[model samples]
Target: MKTLINFAVILFFAIAFNGIAYSNDECSFNGIDDVLYFQENSISNLREITVEACVKVNSFSARKSGANEIWQFIIFKKNQLDHFNEGFAIYLDEKNERFATSVASAKGIQAVIVDKKHSVELGRWYRLRMSANSKEIKFFVDGVLVKSAPTGFPLDFDSEELFIGGRTKILKDKDFEGRFCGSIKNIKIWSKVLDEDD
Candidate 1:
């Protein structure tokens, strides 16, 4: 992991100004409609990847779908319309009060969902980490390993645009409701699968 961190190429990516605000050393998102966009070229084509973020969720959206599906995205990059596609995402399952991470392929969405034991609470900060490769996907909360699952799929995806805090350009509509309401900071991404030691 150390060697990969040192030698592998890292893309810091662009952060476009949106409704989000940087205050007290973190970017705060209004649950209504706040999002940050990343440049396409900087975050595309990864075989193995690791993503980490420090977050404090203020509140989830009050609205719920007919099916009672509620999702609050932390990091998302995929076809907005389809779930079974080429991409990966990390999001909060608002209905279940847990964090979920998944990678998509033609086979379907392969996910590792954190158990109810690590439920996300309001106004508290959490260090969330996810690492994925062709063999497995692992998720962590703070420094503790939560869940690891076998997920054999290439991490590379077709979409170049990436989003943080919420799904891009879809917050106004209720059709794809996964806008996140939280404070996020110290986001790091690596184009290599990081180990537990990292």
Candidate 2:
């Protein structure tokens, strides 16, 4: 009877170990050619927005070599035809090893804020959050407010696509060449800015 009980315990341990080893909770990007996009009809025309993600960066280096600064985008939605046009984006700066977010209005006004105080470490998962409204924009890391600033105008973009992990077109400078090299999961988006306490 004791031998049978020991076998059952070992069986349970094996199942649990395999479950964790093959977990598929996060989406991994190759930092090259791996991208997820949604049509504007599915997600667009937001007066205010909040984006949240659980991200673990594998690397911040660009695929191409000549760019001055490397940018790895986690979520990018902007005009496909125009570079740096009206839209919103959340990305990491390779040089600074920090998170940055930007919002643009249809009228060409733009606002950007970076988490200057916090530098993210590679292979560490972070709960990155950005909330933007007509009045202001806020950036949070791991539930802590990192940066906030008054937005020049409410974010309004007529982009035809919403991209996760990468974009359709490469920027002129090509600094953001590699896209994002990381695992992202639990991405949440809201039409209304969520209260901090919530």
Q: Relative to the true structure, how large is the alpha-carbon lDDT of every model?
A: 0.67, 0.68
The list of candidate 2 runs beyond 4 A from truth reads 1-23, 64-68, 79-81, 169-178
**Per-prediction backbone clash count:** 0, 0
Which candidate number would show the highest lDDT if scored against the true structure?
2
**Candidate 2 positional error at 188, Å:** 0.9
Clashing pairs in 2: none
> lDDT per residue, candidate 1, 145-167, as tens digits?
88888887656565556777765
- Residue-wise C-alpha lDDT for candidate 2, range 1-198, written one tens digit per residue: 011011123323432533312135566776765666555443466778887778888887744322434777888777322545537788888778888888877666777888873488989999988888889888888888888889867677664767767655453454434468877776677776765555
- Quote each prediction's TM-score: 0.81, 0.78
